[model samples]
Target: MSDKLPQNRNNEEVDLLVLFDYFGKSINRVINFFYKIIKGIFSFFIYALKPFIRNFKLIASVVLVSAILGFIIQKTQRDVYTSQMLVKPYFDSKYQLVTNIKYYNALINEKDYAQLQEIFNISEEDTKQIISFDIHSGPENENDKIVQYDEFLKSIDSSRAKNISFKEFVENRSIYSGDVFQIEVFSHKKDIFRSLEEGLNTTFTNTYSVKKMQKRDSLISIERQNILSSIKQVDSLQKVYIDVMNDEANSNKGSYTTKDGMSFIQERTKTKEYELLKESMQLRQALSELDAQKVEEDVYFDTLSSFQDTGEKYTSIWRVYTLIFPLAAFVTLCFVFTGKNIIRFIVNYEA
Candidate 1:
């Protein structure tokens, strides 16, 4: 048994050596594969740079001429000015407001200066200066978002509400979901914004919004009449309860003896006048709230902030073509060289 043990140990050592050799070869192959990928990427980058390196002078001249042309255009174009107004619309008038803003943009695009003149009540020359109109939701804090989310949850089905989280609700909400909106107008004339406000003001009172407002007022009137009637009934019941108690006190009879000579204890009656009073107070409070709501939202829309008399000069990064032209020229040259090389490769290729 001792003699066989050494031979067995030698065979085990040989097997381990073979396994280690196989693993080392596999690791070497993986390393070689990654190395080849890195080398090929570096070679391709150098090849791409060769054309730009060889034709540096020509590329520089083209880029310089394009930059000069862009600078000239930038200097010659008319300057733009922009102004903003904030508004809170009631009775879903925001829908009409957004629609009107789009209509204004369309009119501007179509260059219907005559129609624009009628709408804004401005001269044809002033209307020609108008560039664009835009509207988007105004700023709101987290608490406002939470309140809106709660309302949205209540407005939908309970099963669907369970699948929606607060973050999801906020992310999915549209511009019309907001209660306030900011209207922006762009024009070449700095003072043109103030004149556009009158036209914008007319946008919030469409036929739909008018009917909705009337319906709300009618409902409030009905509710007010019902609450007043309830208060009157409660008052009458209270008066009857008071009279009954007063009469009982004056009777001076705690217990009465029957003809059988059996004396019975008198059981005083209980009145829920206190509960009735609480109900009356609650009803009155609800009625007051309804009146307050109607008073606050009577108008079609409220202007939180009006447009400035003179708009500020507007600038955009996209308008800075002095720097843009040179970059664009470089990219265009790269594409041209790449195409030339491909065509040459195809012509010289031997299938």
Candidate 2:
């Protein structure tokens, strides 16, 4: 048995040694693999940079010339002025507003100065100065986003709504999801924006929006009539209860037993005046709200802020051609050098 024990211990020691050897080899292999990847990447970058280094002077000259040309072009370009208007559309007028803004842009692109002249009531010369029109969702705070998310959840299936988080909902919402919008007009003439407003004002009154407003007004009228009828009924019941109480107070009968057809039970159940009064107040309040709603949203849209009389000069980083040209030149040179080298390699190949 002792001999067998020594032999078993020797076998276990050999197995452990073999396993250690296998693990050591794997670790070395992994380290070599990573080292080779890093070396290959470093060599590739050096090879790619060699062409730029060899033609440094030529590249510098071309970039400098391009930058100078771009600077001159930028200086010669006319200045653009921009102004913004904020509006809150009712009765789904925002859809028409966005659509009309796009139409205006299309007209500008087509250079239909005649149609533009009629739209803005501006002269041909003024219409020529018009550049572009843009619209986007206006500013909103965190509370507004949360309210919108809550409304969206209510509008969808409960099971689907459970899967949608507030962050996801906000990220997925489109421009039309917003209640307010900002309309921007770009033009060469600084004072052109204010004139465009009269045209934009006309955009909010589309056939669909007009019909929607009419439908809303009709619904409100019906609701108001129903609430008025309920109020009248409540007042009549209240008057009857008051008269019954007054008759009971004035009478001085000792028995005071009320007869219901033949039998007398001597039970006097009072009217629920408090509950009726509460219901009457609620109905009247609802009527007031309906009237207020009609008064508030009488128009298709409300102009939260109008365009400025004179627009401010518009500037953008993309318009900085001095920087743009040099970058473009460098990238073009890189592509050219790469293509030349590839063609040379293909021609000189011995396969």
Top-TM-score structure, candidate number? 1
Root-mean-square deviation per candidate: 3.5, 4.8
Q: Give one digit per residue, the lDDT tens place, for model 2 in 195-279.
A: 8889889999988998999999999999999999999999999999999877776666424444664444444547989999999
Can you give the TM-score per candidate against the true fold?
Answer: 0.86, 0.85
Residue pairs with clashing backbones, model 1: none
Q: What local lDDT score does residue 247 receive in model 2, on the 0 to 100 scale?
A: 77
Candidate 1 structure quality by residue, lDDT tens digits, 1-351: 999999999999999999999999999999999999999999999988899899999999999998998899899999999999999999999999999899989999999999889988989999999999999999899999999999999999999999999999889899988999999999999998889899889999889999999999999999999999998999999899888888777775868899999998777678888998899899899989999999999999999999999999999987888888888998999999999989998999999
Model 1 scores worst on lDDT over the 10 consecutive residues at 246-255
Once fitted onto the true fold, the runs of candidate 1 whose alpha carbons sit more than 4 angstroms away are 1-28, 157-168, 246-268
Model 1 RMSD, rounded to 1 decimal: 3.5
Question: Which runs of model 2 end up more than 4 angstroms from their true locations?
Answer: 1-35, 153-168, 254-269
Pairs with backbone N, CA or C atoms under 3 Å apart (clashes), candidate 2: none
Poorest stretch of ten by lDDT in candidate 2: 254-263
